[model samples]
Target: MATMSSICAPMISVLPRRPMIVAAFQQYCSRRTFRRTLQVRSCSSATSHVAPLRRLANYHPNIWTDEHVQSLTSTSKVQREEERERINVLKEQTRNLIREKQQVAEQLQLIDHLQQLGVAYHFKDEIADVLSRLHASLDHVRWELKDDLHATALLFRLLRAKGFSVSQDLFETFRDEKGNFEARCENPIRGLLSLYEASYYEKEGESVLKEAMDFATEQLKALMEEGSVPEAGGLREQVAHALQIPLNWRLERVHHRWFIEACSGDNTIDPLLLEFAKHDFNLVQDMYKSELKELSKWWSELGLSEKLPFFRDRLFENYLWAVGFTYEPDNWRCRLNETKAICFITLIDDIYDVYGTLDELQIFTDVVNRWDLTAMDKLPEYMRLCFFALFNFVHDEGYRVMKEKGLDIVPDLKRTWGDLWTADFEEAKWFHHDQTPKLEEYLENAWVSISGPTILVNAYCMGKDLTGEALKSFPSYYQITRFSSRLFRLIDDMGTSTDELERGDVAKCIQCYMHEKGVSEEVARSEIRELIKKHWRALNASLSWDSPFQEYFKNIVVNVPRTAYFFYQDGDGYGKPDGETKSQIISIVFEPIQI
Candidate 1:
């Protein structure tokens, strides 16, 4: 042992290089004997006059020269130092590899677990659980590793790709760590579905999508405890209680599809019909103010003086009726206008053609013609609505076409017309009968043709003029009207027989009409088809009348097939529906008319 604190400590000390040599000398031989016995030791001792070995038998040198000792000491220190350094390097390398392997293993485990979960993780319930687990893990990591970015993001991708269950706030709070989010979303199945789903939600997931949803029940509970969340106050329950709405496939699908089809084709239904339907269907909530303003401006610019006088009031009434007819049932304007139009049309049609004598008609006509709107004070209350409608609608461009068709060719035609119009109530009623044997039957048949493919054209105009909540889509209207018309026509046509019609059957006119159209005898009725084509042309022209109902009317005429009119049953005198007929009609016709 050595005390190196000594100031006089030897600068260099040498010891035997070999452990075996040093041990052998110490155990076996004395230094004097060893020196005398060894040839080199003997020679060196003689020359140096080797100090007489003290106690030769037990002689032991305090100082000795041995190259091995010095070499051994130097090698031992160097070897120990090298060994220490190697052990340290190995431990450091192993620790680093362990960390790397742990990360890879964790990711693999996650992937395998997710694969087992399958795509169900992308939906709601399962997705929420996955997100909860993921968020919990993150929370642990945030505490354990102080929010490692690479670690957190991989978990985020897993959660997002599978489905989101976390609040947008939580997701956004970690967005800085989500470097290149779009680039990370490379999974094809995940990408397609995610994009489609995102289209229904907000573009920026930060506020609504990610932050809005709670990641965990605990998190939700926390918010409630803090009073940060608002109460819904049973609003949804109230809404459900107030309404028992049913689904209408016709309104939702068939009518919309058919309307678009008709509008796209080379038919009289105005092309704008589909546009109108779309506006009412989708944009009504947002675009109401602008639409009303434009409609009013158009009305003010066009006055009643430009329209044909005879059909002028009728056109105006129709316009007002349109405004009322196309809005939701709860709308005040709609209700008001509906009441006014219904009474006005019912009374005016009767007064003009059926209800009044020629003298009365003349006086009424003179009253409307000679005076301004103020003079309507002398007429019945219903007349006021009629006069206003006429005054306003005549100002529309629709009447110009009828005038140009040489309809007003005769001079002093009113004077001649008053005489001609005298006492024709019976004839007019007969003409009405000639047109349709029964009122219900007539309305049903007309409604079918009007609603089917025809609504698309008319929807455009209706959408343009109406305001407030969208009552019903043009497509829905067409569907309802078509189904109604077809159901009635089918029952009416099938009930009648050719034999019955030949027997001077005035009762089952539906059958008579079918026979007149030669529907039964001929497999493919060419003449009937030609008549339909002509009717369609007329209907198209009628729809183009440039009135407010122009678009609505156009669709009615265009979408409905003429053949559908023949669907009614034909009976000898009058027809009745079969037992199953009502149910079948209700199922097919009425089921699809919901909003």
Candidate 2:
């Protein structure tokens, strides 16, 4: 705890701040304001006293039709097997390419293309070998490759990603006599973008990298204004993309989709890697299609879409999110498990928030806490089905965990459900009473309500190779989960608060801060943004060897917060992803890139 505070505290002061286009959603939902958006289904505001619910469309029904789910396609069994064989062939071909001892820049650029095109995950050992060799030569390359921004920037990125202790001093060569970035006015976009992207990997106290961020960001923004210039259109596009989401913060799958499309016109990209990337992506997309179909079928069977009339039925968004968390085709089973669990969580969240009355909410919470069928009889009509659904899902999950990990997961599952409901009940209490707790008070419950801990704990249950010892070591109390959960809450509240406030609900960080400080919303948001960075800094610090969790689990935990950024960045993409989120879904799962 002391280490966490110390790590977060210093880094909170590390960097200064900088600054959604969800139009398709607005057009589809057709609500003038998102506050009244999902007024669908009978699952309107549950406060009871908030009479005459906001005049809006029925906010919740299965938006996708049977045809939609049926139409989602994967190649046939023989085709996928063939595809796998082709992938192995391409994998070896790419391996030979990475194995070749070409010029230093040539090899680095090949590695870069492999990574940017998203095929790099297939070449991890080879990539690691190359980077390890390069790192050993770093001191020598320092003097030789100094002032070569493009190569140096790529090296920093590759080394840092491979876990090498890269120095920020690699960028010092780009500074002028005044210790300012050289500004490469004649032509600096590529170097600037590379440096800008690398700056994101700097650890705390690296003020030089922070300055590079400022320099690169400013330059990128100015260049982005030039808009598709003949010489720099691609550069402008790349800069704009980097400026939007730093390389570290970028969601891995989404980055590949964007990078592949961006590279289409560039002649310098290696054709083999690009071609392999498209096939690999399409092959993966086939897996995603199969998984989504399974989830869609499970959702259809659960009958929550029909029984729980007003709850948000976001199956597509739920699976899309699960993809961000675990996208490798090898983990399709885990992805499906995660998708189903989150769908349950999302359904239960809405049931607690928008459907159940305050009295019904309390009873449902108690029933879930009890974790028994006998308790189901205590529930009201609407609550009965939800309680039954949740119990069945968790019991099945417990069985799965016991079968695989030899762990009695029921206790942990009960704990997560109990905690999630307690958090839900607290928010309902606050909303009904119109009380805005102190920001800290609100955030304490908000993080739990955001439900990262519960779902991640569930993830621990469903994940492979998690033994009881690892389970005890995890215990849902780790700093990584706590920090990322907090980030998820803060980000969610910032994006969804306006609508939530309109509907009359719990006070979020933004509202709590505004109420506590009597500040403007914009100012509160800016400060909240800074607090998010502090949390990410803490989250990052928690991932070192000092942490008890395994490295693979650590990587998964990191994506918890990144998932929030992706869905919430453009106006509740999870809730109404028809706009920008729609485009992302198409690129990630539906559409195949033409080689």
Candidate 3:
């Protein structure tokens, strides 16, 4: 039997050509006469006589303090019990409703509502049964929905979303002899909205869905411009919201409260279903508060905020990220461990990006790669503390997994940590040497540097059961990881590159593209947006691929980019959270829905 270490050694070697390219770039950079202008003071003892010049981001203090987070309380135990009982009853009623709905359209709408309200996990089996039946009888479904554009689009979206093999050819029924979506499909706002949302589920090379997207978008915008959409029932608001960010891309937990509020204004919504959604949301929110309180205590005790004051203290944001990845009450362990990993990633990211001199960063990277206590003495005091904090967290997690599942994942954890630091160190070298690689070269390293692999790998270790076979099959999963990380890096660059450049960081993907193509910044941004869409299509296609990973881990992979899109949609939401991010956090984490 192959050892886990031997089976997983290749996971750390993403983009093997990257090192040679980086070396050549460094060789070229070292020969440039202009290098002296870019060099900064080193933080080594040899330069102890000179005060080291450090770049400070001056990030705002955390809006949600540890004291406030620790002070949070949920409902009393008795009330929580009562609510749980009521929710169970509601679940039964919802189940019966699913069973009773003989019509395919009704079943699809019910499942869509349940998902939108963020309570679909309760009825996964029921929803799957319906989709399976509908998928099994595609001919009957096609006949039933032939004239009904709205139901057909809803069916296609829901079925495809569940990884069912639904064909885009089903949409041809609505097209005319010219192979264009008929004008009759335009006036029905409900059908148009459904088509628009469903179009986002398109895989690459699907020209029909692309046309449908363009048609629906044009009609929807035209109707809005003509003031034709009804102002009542929140339909207008729904259109605007979908236009801003489609349902397929938005984070589920973050969209839950908004959808619940939207349903309240919708007269067509069932009173019982709406009640169930509210209670479920509050109960889930209660669970999150408890988790946050405990995590807050953990963060407070970790004392990294005081020890490394230069980094952003973003415990609340990190918790939001964990919840975005996995919001089920049963998966609290995954959420907690994920938050801890992200906190350390953020702290270490700051060390490379903002504070650490190149020499100090290289030393820290070497220490992390060695994964040894003896190597810690070479790092600065601050780097030593950060290294130990990461070391203990990773080993502690590895210990838990080993004790529970008889799998020692310490080597896996250490490899991902080393990979992340190596990528970060490469970027630091780029910054210090004033070299701008092409966009492809930048992303080959930036994707890993973005910390998506590290976060996802930790998630896999803590959330999934490990076996020798699973470890053997792990290399295949890295493709999805790369896709997720690529999207994450691009979205992050779009949001933070301006500030990063001002603070003397390496050239991000956007800047790399502009330099490579000799295009304007506006053109570069537009191109990056196109790349985001392209990667999303690739990711959507990858979800249906057969792999050793269960849907639980796969969903986390997809949600990584979805969460990034949410935070960076407006502007550096995680780094500067005082704007819309603050209100969003309050709604999702703190404020309970009024039942």
Candidate 4:
């Protein structure tokens, strides 16, 4: 295990020495006269006398400026050292508590808190050992939890979430002969909430869990309507939040502060545990600020926002999205590189959807497929700059891998970019032709167009546990990647399709479904929501299979969709960040937990 200092030290040493070409680009961007002239020239190619009529989305300017981001700083040295020492002490103490004997309910509750508090990564071995022991003593554990819906559901969820083969039939103990959950199970509210959350882990054909979900959902909503729950602590608030989005579906880091504050108010939790969680969260947040500062400088220096001003300038949101994928402290490199990939994805997505003419898009796609520097001459000035940035990013990553692991991943990286551009070009063709594709036809391309595979491929390369075997086995993870990408596309379409359609973009999944089925928009949206749920089940099921991918890589793959839900659950959170998205970014990235 690397210390936080060691994990962060590389950034300080490596970021300042950028390649000379990037510095020249930055110098060009710094010149206002040259930038304006280049922007005008790039909008209209030399081959055409007329400037193409571009469809601009008119995205909102980013609220987090480079000055603000760079101004963010960490705590004093004395305070940092104290917190580190205190965290180390609490970590060992927490491990001892996990090892201590307790009731099944108590032990499961502790594990749940550790996970929600975002400190469970420190005790994975201990948690696994405890779960293994509990799994082996099923008869006794069942006897103890047979009457306790909360414990039974928690055990079922935690087990299933960790890839244990626990049966959903365990929930059958709470149901009556009429196939309805008994009224007695509804009093505790916690039990109903637990059951509600646990049902989200259900795979296909699990009718019992589905029934449990529906019943618990109805009961919880009724309770909320009647205002019958006690408001003493955060239980009522937690119940309300869970009703909006189940715990299983949430990105933990996005909601970490809420959970931490909720736990702070709970009298049943240990003081030491709560204290440790606060310090740990703040410490990690400090690391995030450092990474953001470096990334802000890098993005500012790259000059994309200034050079190509039509696209969305969402560096802050991109970093937030990367954090959603993997928030552990040691994986800062993954977060940084993933943010870069997301930025390019956003940039290229806009080029194809909003700016590029059909002919230019075809040429761009062909150039990407060629994956050669010689092809750079065919693109417009703006596109040439974009391609050069992407080319540098891919090879830089490839060079790092080659230097570290003696593996050349440039071909794999280029292939992902090629697939993404190809998909984008297909969509551009559809929009250009005023074509509404069949739902199936649209989805076949929309998944790749969503950029999940590109992001996951880059994540696998930057992440630890990479191997020659894993590189060869990359194609075999298609089921996981496809499921995740399909979910991202469906969820994104559900949230952003209206805005996208109104702005003269291609028809998204919802519109395709409506056109194909001849249904109302409401019906189309509801059906798309069902599709999201279906793919989620498939994604969960894929994780349970024996795959050649490492568990870390699998988590990153699944988290792609999870992060999408975070951004798009309300509506185009990434595109329009003034609402909940802004608040979440302020809370998770900027604001530290009060100690």
lDDT of 2 by residue, 1-595 (tens): 1122222211111112111123322232232233234333213544454442422224534456546977986778897798788888888988998778466766788988887787877876787778778888888877766657777888887777555677788878778889998744234667787788777776667789889889888877876676532443366567667777887776778888888888776766876777788889988887787777778888887887787667677888787778777666655666787788787787677765665556677788777777768877777666788778878888887887777767897877778777777777877665544455778877777778888877777777666667777777664446778887898888788777776555445557876676666666778889999888778666655654322236456656777777778888767666676777778887787787775
Report lDDT (Cα) of residue 88, candidate 1: 50
Winning model by lDDT: 3
In model 4, the worst 10-residue window by lDDT is: 1-10
Predicted candidate 3 versus true structure: per-residue lDDT over 421-510, tens digit per residue = 888888777777656777887888888889888888888877655576676565667778888989999999999876666565667887
- The worst-scoring run of ten residues by lDDT in candidate 2 lies at 9-18
TM-score of each: 0.23, 0.85, 0.92, 0.90
CA shift of 288, model 4, Å: 0.2
lDDT of 4 by residue, 44-71 (tens): 6535777765667898888889999988
lDDT over C-alpha atoms for residue 530 of model 2: 84
Ordered from best to worst lDDT, the candidate numbers read 3, 4, 2, 1
Candidate 3 Cα errors over 4 Å, as ranges: 1-38, 43-51, 183-187, 464-468, 545-549
Stretches of candidate 4 above 4 Å error?
1-48, 183-187, 545-549
TM-score, cand. 3 vs. native: 0.92
Number of the top-ranking candidate, with TM-score as the measure: 3
Task: Give me the runs in candidate 2 sitting further than 4 Å from their true place.
Answer: 1-61, 76-82, 102-107, 135-138, 162-164, 183-187, 226-233, 545-549
Q: Weakest 10 consecutive residues, lDDT, candidate 1?
A: 1-10
